[model samples]
Target: MATMQECPRSPEAKLGMRVEDLWDIQEAQLSPTEKLNACFESIPVSAFPLPSSNQEVEIKSDATLSEAVKILAHHNILSAPVVNVDAPEDASWIDRYIGIVEFAGIVVWILHQSEPASPKSPSTPTSATAIAAAANGNTFALELEALGLGSASTTSGNFFEDLTSSELYKNTKVRDISGTFRWAPFLALERSNSFLTMLLLLSKYKMKSVPVVDLGAGRIDNIITQAAVIHMVAECAGLQWFENWGTKKLSDVGLPLVSPKQIIKVYEDEPVLQAFKVMRKEKVGGVPVIKSGSNTPVGNISLRDVQFLLTAPEIYHDYRAITVKDFMTAVSSYLEKNKTAFSMSCEFVTCKMDCTVKELIQLLDREKIHRVYVVDNNGDLEGLISLRDIISRLVDEPRGYFGDFFDGVLPLPANSRV
Candidate 1:
């Protein structure tokens, strides 16, 4: 693991520094105070405009299951914000932000509602069997425009209507509702850090695109995606050693800023099922929720969390009967009980803000953990690092050649003997 050192502040020492000046300047390179002040700063949101609201797709809360599906499909969306059709336009119906109904939710509902006796014989199919089979087909292929229940037959309507037409059109009342899903509490970095530090931090965090904030003005600047980081690093490496030997701050590079509103979010108290639904529908990794209007983030729920809950029989059973409060484990609890009470192998990993990327990677690899919480010296979470961050950086890179020589046989040049 890399060691931390203090930075030199003497003006005479830094006046005409060169790349070689940094080789023995480990103390100055790793000082948290120096790096923190130099590398980390907040960018304002105004620079990056908030994402425009998605065009609302209105659906009656009581619409037939088929109608709901049609609306989702027609809009080419994964979920449609629901509303009460009978309510007046200015009724402040915002309180009625009833949870979104997503394709995943619909699938789960259908799977649960399916009768066990309907398909005992695999060879001999029944009406329920056919419906199940069709619904189980490539869900991704179903056009986004063909998601709502209203246009069931026009796309997959015959399958839905044939199975549950009577219950859908007659018993379900269509209410008016409209809304879009969002993810939030996103962190953006400025271009002041070295390509190496950016690579290290990004690999540690498992982020796709980190929004860049302008430290000077405290506003969103641009975005630094995994691709951007890799390209920048590759370019830096190609420079002569004299040109690229020293550490570079984040701002030295030119990364644009992104706004907080561009991030998606959900309430902390929301059902985990709803989180899963939105993730599936929007095709995002996770959602960040605030503790209310405060900028302090409560917690983030990701697709991996949902998958873990679903795959664990005990967890899934408990989830069916319990609320989010019942399952949520406070982050503080994990830190307080580290190593002694909580076995490193089975438990999550965490680190302080001062931890280096090399240290984080070793810990993650050794413990086989997916993510680690980054805390301050006081142990309060500052951010999170995950395998996704590492993998994202490697996405477009070419694989090395070690695998081709696994047998220990070496290929000789065309004109030479083995």
Candidate 2:
């Protein structure tokens, strides 16, 4: 969270290096950023370095949510490309895959199942404070009835049990939940595609990982992820161009594009289930946590955090009494005790409003996190930033900079975020 003093940024400061200069300037005379842009434009996906030995885990289409969670947790990845379980030998690349399954998708499915189908059906269950309320002999429910703040007709009793033990969790396959998340695109990057296209796919299109499928071989070579992109940026530490832009304070870059009021956060006292629901509905990877009645952030929780409930239910004694605060405390202690590298970012990651982009980059790379919160002098939350925010700042308009990057791809749905 090391930061610079708050300062004003010139209104006319350039958003990105000029693209035309990349094409016209002599290689020796070009500025570092201009040269870097040209280099990225010329490099194809095929030229990117090989994935680490432990990476590239894929989930079969038939894998149940339970099985998928184990695979991801076992590999410690956030998402996996799902191969077609019944594809013929000569199938097209698209035909050979159903879609990528993500931790976020599973959470969405579990939340959907908790919806009360009918008045006669069991009430939708809850976790953290909701479950704690239920555990107290329905006293909260009775009080709600007396106060008219809640009613038996709406979400009355324990609606969802332990998430992993729920019927839907055991029975549902990865294929069955394809429609659960609004942003689950199965797009694959071709070997011939440019690096800028990959960046835009990850940053602009909100792709968590772009599967690199070799159509000629009909096999995946590697998955390009935001972490990989950040790692590359981190490696450019000594480069003059990176330092030029990276040295600028976050205020100069202006990311986390949304204002404080636009942020989707959960109070520590609220039910943890509500945190997951709002995250799914809002299409955010992680949600920030605010101390009740205060702007300060106590922690940050991600959709991927559910791996605990999925793979290691033993971590929490009473899953029902787990409030968002309790969830954070248990997770932080567990990670520290075991020192597992499973998103050390989820516990408590915050920064000052004037943190340098370079500082943010190193923090994310070191902590293995996707997002970080920005707080004020009082450590009160100001905004939440992510890998996407950093990459998005690298270019002005991706669509215009990378010509025809979307050619022959399926058209984006009209409702997609522009």
Output the number of the TM-score-best candidate.
2
TM-score of each: 0.31, 0.78
Q: Candidate 2 residues 83-161, lDDT tens each?
A: 8889999888888877777776676654554334345643443322253244333333333233222221222113223
How far is each candidate from the true structure, as Cα RMSD in Å?
22.6, 9.4
Model 1 agreement with the true structure over 318-354: per-residue lDDT tens digits: 2323233333453223335543532223343556545
**Model 2 stretches astray by more than 4 angstroms:** 1-36, 116-163, 182-184, 340-343, 398-418
Each candidate: how many clashes? 62, 5
Q: In candidate 1, what residue range of length 10 has the lowest lDDT sum?
A: 249-258
The prediction achieving the highest lDDT against the true structure is 2
lDDT of 1 at 295: 49
Provide the lDDT at 367 for model 1: 59
